[model samples]
Every structure is written in structure tokens, then in C-alpha cells.
Target: MATQTSIPASHDRDFYAWALESANRLRAGNLAGLDLQRIAEEIEGMGRAEKHALASHLKILILHLLKWRYQPTLRSLSWQLSIANARDEIAELLEDSPSLTGKLPEILARRYPAARQGAILETGLPAATFPTGCPLTVEQLLDPEYWT
Candidate 1:
């Protein structure tokens, strides 16, 4: 039998090594060997990452929708593809973490202002061109057919 080499739990030095070691330690039933604090932090960090990703994709999707609706003359394949890609990514995230679906309304509401500003900046349109609040519903944002 090959002896499994153990890695040091130094999160600051080598996170990849630490993660691998943590998993190995966990599989070996060595709870005492685990870096409890760091592991907890990493787990929490993962949830935060998922939320951040959801927010980012939502922002991009909203930004593109804004552009598509307000700047019809400037529409391109890129914007359409961006909208599709963001939706696909968000769908995948939700599929993997259904619990996040419940958080969508809040995430969208929080992310919309930034997306609206992004649309303004990208479209070179006045802030007034876009609604102060998101005009699209969560359903419309996710529905592939809504804007098409």
C-alpha cells in the first residue's frame, strides 16, 4: 500500500495544498488533524463566492438586457450571446445550489443599481435613459424568450 503523504495546513502559504490535505485528512477520519478554523472559513468563503458569482452573472444579464432594450440600434451578436451566456451560467448555479434560488430576489435587487450604472457607462447613455430601478422582473430576466 502506498503511504499517503500529508500536507501542512498552512492556508496562507499554499491554499491548494491545504485544501488537498484537508480533504485527505477528512477522508482518513482524522477530525483532530483538520484545521477547523480555516476549514470553516473556507466553507463560508465558498458560499460567499457562490453569492458573488450569482450577483456578477445577474449584473451582466441585467446590463445586457438594458442595452438590448434601450440601445436597439447598437445591438450586436455579442450582446445577445452575453445575455445567453449569463442566463446559462445563472441557471447552472441555481441547479447546483437550489437554495440560492430563494436568494435571487434579494441578489437581483441589490445588484440592479450596479447593473444599471454599468449599462449607462457601456452604452454611453444618460442615467435617465435607464430606469432608476430594474424594470424587468426576475422571471423576465431568466426567461430566454422574454426579450428575444
Candidate 2:
């Protein structure tokens, strides 16, 4: 019988190796739909260290998705890339500094306090009225009265 070990199998392999292999496979030219659930499960099973190594690779994957989905301009792409890099750096910093985790709640509260309640107006706006003269705008130009 195999003994149960606290150390998971993913930890047995070097994180860089696993991350690189996973990224290479993901980046390989393929048009077929991916099994996202299965891929997520596989990543979830990885050890903490592996997860950290994989963050950068995952960031790249997200950037690719953003680029494809939005077809952003080069300037927009550069800005987004910078933001992604900053996010990855923050993740690395948090992972390396475990002590920061303890103060996360306080830090978050300080950075973003709870939303304040605001009173809502119950009054409704009056219906809009069109100008008496012939509508010069496209919307008015298309009106039946303008055509008549």
C-alpha cells in the first residue's frame, strides 16, 4: 500500500519545468476549443511554489486573450501589458512576503473603504419635446414630418 504524503506530486517536480511545459503546450498553434475546466483543475492541483511560477505564464495567457478579444491599438496593448506586468509583480511580492497576508484586510479597508449609502430621488423626469422647426439633425431629418 502506498503511504499518504503531505507533499503533493506537483511539488516533486521543479515549478519552472512544469510551468514552462504547460505554457509551451498552451501556446502551441491550435484553433480547437480548449478544455478549460480540465486545465484549471490541473493547475489547481499544483503546489504553492508551482502556482507562483505559473502566475507569470498565466498572465501572458490572459494578455493573449485580451489582445484577441479586444483587438486593441498598439498603444492600448502597451498600457495593458504594463498593467499585467505590475499585477504579476504584486503577486510575486505577496507570495514571497507571507507576513503581508496577515495585514491584507486592513490594507484593503484602508485602500478601499466600504461604499457609503446615498439617498435615491423618487421624482421622474418630464417627457422630452422636439423643436417646432424642421429637425436639422439626422434623427429629425429621418422624421416623417421632415419628409412631409
Candidate achieving the largest lDDT: 1
Model 1 agreement with the true structure over 33-147: per-residue lDDT tens digits: 6778879999999999999999999999999999999988989999999999999999999999899999999999999999999998998999998988889999999998978
Angstrom error at residue 105, model 2: 2.4
Residue pairs clashing, model 1: none
lDDT of each: 0.91, 0.38
Candidate 1 lDDT trough over 10 residues, lowest sum: 5-14
Per-residue lDDT of 44-67 in model 2, one digit per residue for the tens? 665454544434333332333233
Models 1 onward score TM values of: 0.91, 0.24
**Against the true structure, candidate 1 has what lDDT?**
0.91
Off by over 4 Å in 2: 1-75, 113-148
State in Å the error of residue 82, model 1.
Answer: 0.4
